[model samples]
Target: MSLHDTSSEGRLQGRPQTGSQPAIALIDGNNFYASCEAVMDPSLLGRPLVVLSNNDGCIVSRSAEARRLGIAMGTPYFQVQRQLERLGVEVRSSNYALYADMSQRLMATLERWVEELEVYSIDEAFGLLSRREGEDLSSWGRQVRRAVRRELGLPVAVGLASTKVLAKLANRLAKTQPAHGHVFDLEAQADPTPWLEQVAIEDVWGIGRRLARWCRLRGVADARALRDMPSGELRQKCGVVGLRLQQELRGHRCLPLTLVPPPKQETCVSRSFSQPVRTADALRQALATYTVRAAEKLRRQHQRAGALSVFVRSNPFNGTSFYSNSATVTLAVPSNDTAVLLAAALPLAETLFRPCHPLQKAGVLLLQLQGEEQLQHHLLQPLPPEQQQRRAALMAVLDRLNRRYGSGTVRWAACGLQPAWAMRRERLSRAATTRLEAIPRVLAR
Candidate 1:
């Protein structure tokens, strides 16, 4: 059935109209990075905009206007520089701080309506909604979208269905099909065959390029074909995972909403430097900075690492010479203290460093993480209770200061005063929500 044909007789198709069934909703922010930038500065609205990746290398995101202009995603910024300038397209470096702050606001707004929500990614969330008798999910979805726009000035598309996979498909249609009014509910349709046929197999959630190619070779071109494919053959070739996906498309819910996220197994902090560094001191500074970040993440999760790894690598693209090495050290006791992790990681950086090779990337990994409640005192190197208390108190003060005044307010001396190898974000926007100094000021005329 055409989405435009919404007559009761056509939509019902002998199936009873019911509203008591629960639904899964996939709410996705439209042009998330570009939307985030526009939220901060409304002047950029309706303009062709693109957000670049780390080091301002490639286009990671594009606004609707940019999409219409044929500016493909992942294109090298340098290659499109002249064209973008000629077309008067605006470009911004990836401002993660601003984007993260906007995402938090968006999620908080969604939590007000959803019974349970799973933050699937930085820009999308899966929500479980329990429908009341005679309730219209499409109406509820519109209200949610309105609230997000009013609160955060970010547009969203909502897709509702009995299962997650179908909800994902519905969400895609909600964005692409104007008749849905940015909200599509697959459960409301008596026969979803027409809609399922519209989705290509490759576009289905969890169906990667490899699986799509396999499906195509077997005459499965669209979502409906995959849904009705021979289960025995699918199971024989693609295993139980593929079967579960087919079941999901058939409106049998196999995936449940994750109300609570699992604890992180490890904390890693790694980055590519703006410029390559050849000195041992530069590598040490980079690793020390990464160690502090990893420890901060561990503390945030109320967890500590029992092992640490440090790695340094020269650019693989540099065909002249390439080098990569890593060193791991087992800690005496699980620790989230920056000083302790730094002490363990710095020496490894020194070991991995080669004087002649200009290393482009370095990182520190906090491994074998366990909750702070599971902390065990080492027999050989036991820390006194008072000393442990002091360390915890100091870290708390450091974190509090950083949160209030912005990051790097209090830092270890070893991280260096000014590192030339810092990330290149020349076009970065102000952290209006995060940093006090970056907040915009208005002047009355």
Candidate 2:
């Protein structure tokens, strides 16, 4: 791992070196997905923008302009297209590849700021600042944000606080208040309480809409009220999460930054159908399709599953013959090979298939996983060396072709006939960053 130490000179002052008074920093990309779009295309700046969810169904992300137009996140496209058209919103599908590439660059830029850090989400990262010496965390955060902006052409909001949750809140405040200049220092403020009191309880981390409503009913609608609540009572009501939030709001660090990525114990690929599916063949086809997707994810992660679990279920809300069944097939050898995994799933699919059941959803799970390198070789029986080599070559070729051309350049028949099983992406504009046809063209005509 290459490390870059670019601690800003102006930002480094009176930095403490103790774990007790640990300082934490939260850095969030401003308008992440939408910002990434603007970074790639300068023309997108200052425009009404929206990024669609799978199947282009709903707005997953929106630019500042789109937000001003009152476009809510997750608002279904079919419901908002007319209004969006009137507002002249530039709609695009969630371009994971483009966003991912930009995220990588941004994270790389941030690596210079801290010795220890954790990527909290695709667009947010946290770093430990408590152990550093002669570092003015407030200035340091601002410098880091500026560096990211300059290097990647992406703006960021940086927050420094005693705890993760407070840092998150500070980042929010930084983004909302231009006076902070995209950086917020909770510890630096002499009156952090006033700011905390003004924040709505529902807006606090972990407090959902329902939880906010419950708090509002009790007239406990602000962070100040939540902090004053008896610990025992809060625990009884909202449990440990509430206690953590209260402690965090008071500038107490509770959560530790995870230096390493957490292990994913299980992998799943499941989706509901817009319409009920009938016929054993169709159900099996859906299962197979899901299986292929699951295997692809496993391969991407460089992990192998020891089991293939397949399931088929009928609609629970249909009030009809509600049936749900699943079967797990333990692999003789853990593998990321889609063909091997799919073959194991075929038997499970056969067992789960019931005639005239009208399956509403189907999925596959890769469980009992292990690193491919750590997998033990068979003692009595093993795949031939030639076959192993062939599989490797085949998968490498498949990955290359898909990466170069686009996904599904080569696909299994089991993927099914252009079905709605695909993710909802109705509002997806042309693939502005991936497909050749979608590439922006300069027409001089």
Candidate 3:
């Protein structure tokens, strides 16, 4: 039977006796960042490796070997620098381009097996699956894991269940429990209570720390206990959201597959500088670069921003000397042009700059975004129809060149040729997949 079949006849054939039960399968890459690094360089496999966050400041991802070595996530690199070297652990700064490319490939591979897929994050996705009465979903999941491993050289855990929450729990078990062999199907189990009992209330999906505390206080310590809680009491205390979660845990689906994601309400481009920047020229350069990025994103989405905001901030950890300010500019006519965005954003950088404060971060935010189809033109617009078309054509050409060559193949003069305040990524890896020159070479011998 075809996995994509969803019609009544298709369901009848698949279900045979008990009727079809659609399942949600959550597939997540194991140690995604670390795994992405290993994919590009096979020598790192089975070795202790860690991927650091922006500026190489914090340990954001760790391989199984690294985790076993007691390297915790979010640990400052400075504190663990000595320990990592002593243990012969490899480290790499976040390579977003490589990771993003791998993620896209992973999603495309998954699309082949599932009826509908929702990309939840860079390393995780939810696939809607139709289970036949006698078909083995666990076996099907194994095929998925093997395919991803074979194609992308990335390890993944597959969790199939009647609901998203259970699928999430199943995915966690698939990762932590060696006996599961990296694929767990909650619906396949004759008795799911035992599995649910093994999951702590705090570890359950959608249950935050506060809610976990509340559950613990109420003597609900595990998924089983929470699932069996009185519906009225759960609803009264936690509202509809809580009730929906309980329903999902009880094998009832509440959240439907989001085949098409909703349009973004705002687009923001922000980053912390490698070093504190004090000069006005540096500040303007940073804001202009960020504005260009934000505008590009808007154009890609076929949306225009009605307003732009520029914010500058000093290190919040700098005690009483901390400074932060932002200014918003409303455009007469909505636009996604980099020049238009920079024109409005650069002036705000000058206005918000404080010479005494050493700014640590700056960003550009595009607000009140509207689709091109819904664009409202202003009566006193600065540009006429022909001029607007020319500007758009120029922006399109600029974007194409950048995409074909690489980011910043063509950029605004205001962005500065070599900004000292750029992000610090000393241990950065090559963008092997995205960039032509970064591709790995193999000797004929």
Candidate 4:
């Protein structure tokens, strides 16, 4: 629990003393993935629906109706196959493009309302609220709720607080407690102890299982007890991080809203195939596609991977002949160039692939990532400047065309034409909301 930079923490005026206004709000999309599915196709409304993970293996997102019927999250689709059919449950494979577009729109709407925003995840964000004379913070939070609902057709819960930690706790309550308005204000609480006590020690945002165990060993059972413990004692045990969470529990600002996210240390693109692949060539096809995806992400982020790893595995469902292997290739020069990545990756995939066992999945991982500016040129093995520039320009053009038209509008032949190892999208929802050409048609009188 190392502390993040708190340079922009608290309110503009500073941490308010007694009876001050709320300064932080945690905005979270309700049932984000399921909601995304429902909003795009209103026909799913009030229906028992679950979005499956890659390979249609398991339920990753379930609508409220599906949950009510005891369809547990992460339950393998096979395990619940009979229940789903009997209950007339609808299924959709995850459409990340649609979800990502919706998330971008949601965050864009949020940015317009806040002074500063920290996007915590695809479905959660922390927004800073500036104290204003005659401005009701709670009302402002409510407006955010309304705006997202009306503009994006997305349901969100707002949790207003004096500190980010409390704001997170408030948001948790807003989600769990029916009595709390979709927007709950923790700053308004004269004493947060009672509410904090109700929250489990593990449920606090930063308190993971190890921390929870440590707290229990020290006789600090719940968040309230943790807050009541001397700040110095916890600091001694967990260093500055423990002290900060302790202070945050007592309604003090120790964590700041981050505007810029730290770059990913590694980029991985992988997925299970629709069916088992027994041939090395099929695995090569899968690896090439994943390499393209991973490299595309690396280039888009303005970073280059110094090492590439190729991994393949047999189906977990098959106990016999179960095999998985991975191999890593270190580059002489770091690059985001797709050609460079594929050249190294295909060879590794060939070595890692075992022809005897059928592969359920294959993947590519780009490691030792650094910004493009940090790349060091090899003294003797110099990449030709003219050729490099041409490839860069070509990649840029490819990305632009794909974005403007649709994904796979332009793809490398190495990825194979009609890859048989492609993941199943038999029950995939339409990307009407994301793709320019897929927008739904309307019938008029």
Candidate 5:
């Protein structure tokens, strides 16, 4: 059935929508990484907090207090070290394990109420609603928000709209406008012209800076302006994509929610070092570790890559003798098996290494990815039936054990004993929640 053609719906609370269906709700966690930290340690609440990216190089997540202090995303740690110390703002390394577990709990709570859902990111999801007469969407949204907060201790905002893009806009508004509560209902508003005018064209979902500039040149400066654009002219200017976005902005469903996120085309694992590496073996170890990590993800996704590439380079800081090199190889057979990947990967890493050169970073890239069932076995290099079965079983066992016991419970020999170039996480918080051994203790009075 077609959605409501007229924009004459009433406000959300206490009145049932006289429309065809309920609007899509975009529910997202607020300051997710920082919130995760604050939830675990109550002491960090209301204090300026920042979560650094890999290697503690830059600020990846910041709390509201941190923002008020002028800390921007991607600001290098070195640039604000003095300010952070002087202001007594706490810092933490990105603890992906804790964040992942909390995210699982958060989504589990949302899943109880929302059956048709799409997880857009680690901290964001979209849910479809079923409206009944006399039901209040605002009340329903608050219940969802409160449930997540009560169970998982994670705060979320909801934006309900006729389409996904509008829902995204509504979610943003929900965060900025907290007085009428953290739910924005576009479907309930008779006219959202005032709020639509405030949202810059650049802020709309699926519209990039380049597209915003293109739209601005045509006098479509805001969401309302873009929605009011002439369809034929927009089609001529930005092709069918812009036309569809225009239709979506005008409360039409042009895109459907993807319940399952698609697999990535290319998987690359790259990280900067805590300290400069001066040995070939160290660079080899880094490459081997990354290869194993990438292979784990590939196997988890039931995928295989036909080719692998490795690269190593000198720290750009020491400008005198800077050098970088890379090598790629096509595998005889595509397999997500760690042994198979490292067999092709470590040799390439050795070739890229240079004696006496300072290594700043090294990585592995898996390319030409395809599903495991679609593999083209090599006739010349075909493995014995028994040997192939054993390898597959071994890989499966490693995955299961690691998942049960935690990551790195099983790995290949080439990944090395000591990772000299690992990230610097000196200020990492206690892993009392995720790690069994690190669980907190109580002292009797």
Candidate 6:
């Protein structure tokens, strides 16, 4: 059932092909990070490109040409440097700022075409497409792709089907096969199962290596096999998710096409080495740096922590001596103020520090977190009015400055020198908006 062999007997699927019924459209931008790079530099068009992780460490995404060289994701840049150079693969670091800004613009652009939109990933989104009088949904998909290209300068592939799962499968086919790369509509065929059967189980959504093995054990090897399995059995084995997948495969629309908001994180911090931090001071400095970050997150959330925990550990997996230590301290009063939180935790860090064990990682954690509330004013833990006022004023100014400029625009001296703890990302795209220099600018000819 290849795209090239469209025969007279194929016809279309028995499902209603009219526009009145609900149809799901899954949109995926091709080689998203590489596309991000290409959008910034038009010279990158049709060129081999690879994007690296933080600190220019390893490959994260590669263009089609680069992929043809057998380079893989997470392959250390140093390990494949010669091979990449020989293949002329352009490299860049993980420019999150650039990628994030582009993703936002893409979502905003899609908002114009459909009534409801669900952004699944930075490069993937789903929308409900309804037929207008005498209008073809396939043609509409081309228009959506054109809009993204014209407005955002990024190429996209679209898949249309009766269900979200089918739409996603169509999207995958649209990517692998250039003919379907532009548009894939399951309703246009009498039977899409033949095409669906070609997709491997592991490639399907929610079926990772472990699940794929489990599915293989049950003789379900492809999308069609899993689709045909009894829903009751799938529910019993894989729980609600497997049931949802079963329904989606059967085009029953069990899963809602919904946008996922960024999740609320439980903790936030930055950690680094001391002397290249082969010592306790380096570990302490790293912990202190993260303490500021944790406190800032707490205040930003309008919350406070009742306890602070500091941890220091050697690089265990690096074949070094295993040394790990951690200490937790209860605060007299829950507070988001940096001075109060750091004051409570710094002493604890000292207690947790090992004697010159070449500390590799250190971090701070805030526990028993709660939103700020009107205090009962405990007499035993009362702070002097002037001291409290000073603390509040100091933190306010620090937060303002950091927000206006950027993180680490100002830092407490105790946090120590920035370590090479950051993941290596050499071929990084420019930070399109964060720093003064990294902002994308229009150059007048």
Model 1 Cα lDDT, one tens digit per residue, 1-445 = 3222445533422122444677899999999999999988999999999999999999999999999999999999999999999999999999998999899999877876665679999999998766555445888788889989999999999999889999999999999998998999888887899999999998999999998999999999999999999999999988989998999999899999886789999889999999998888888889889888888889999999999998888998987588988999999999999889888988887688888789999888889999988778899999998998899999999999998888898888889988999988999999999998898999999
Over 1-445, each residue of candidate 6 has an lDDT whose tens digit, in order, gives 2212224432222222335777888988888998899888888988899988755666888888788777888898889988888888888877776788789999877766665689898888888756544344777787888889998899899888878888989888888877765788776667889988989999888788998998899999999999998878788888999988888888898888755444334565644342235555555566777888898878777777877888777777667678887888888877789877878877776687667577666778888777666333457978777976687788889998987777778888876565445434445566655667666778998
Number of the candidate with higher TM-score, 4 or 6: 4
Error of 4 at 91 (Å): 2.0
lDDT of each: 0.88, 0.78, 0.89, 0.84, 0.83, 0.76
Q: In each prediction, how many residue pairs overlap at the backbone (N, C-alpha, C within less than 3 A)?
A: 0, 13, 0, 0, 0, 21
Taking every candidate in turn, the Cα RMSD to the unseen true structure, in Å, is 6.3, 4.5, 3.0, 4.8, 5.1, 7.9
Model 4: colliding residue pairs: none
Q: Give the TM-score of candidate 2.
A: 0.81
For model 3 the TM-score comes to: 0.95
Off by over 4 Å in 4: 1-22, 132-136, 214-219, 230-237
Better of 1 and 5 by lDDT: 1
By summed lDDT, the worst window of 10 consecutive residues in model 3 runs over 10-19
Best by TM-score: 3
- Model 4, CA-based lDDT: 0.84
> What TM-score do all the candidates reach, one by one?
0.94, 0.81, 0.95, 0.90, 0.91, 0.80
Q: For candidate 3, lDDT tens digit of each residue in 31-148?
A: 9999999999999999999999988889999999999998899999999999999999999999988998899999888877777789999999998867777455898898889889
In model 6, state the lDDT of residue 86. 89
Better by lDDT, candidate 5 or 3 = 3
Full-model lDDT, candidate 6: 0.76
Worst 10 residues of 1 by lDDT: 9-18
Better of 3 and 4 by TM-score: 3
| Model 3 C-alpha lDDT versus the unseen true structure | 0.89
Q: Quick one: ranking by lDDT, best first?
A: 3, 1, 4, 5, 2, 6
**Least well predicted 10-residue stretch by lDDT in candidate 4:** 10-19
Q: Candidate 5's residue-wise lDDT over 280-316, tens digit each?
A: 7787788889999999899878899999988777877
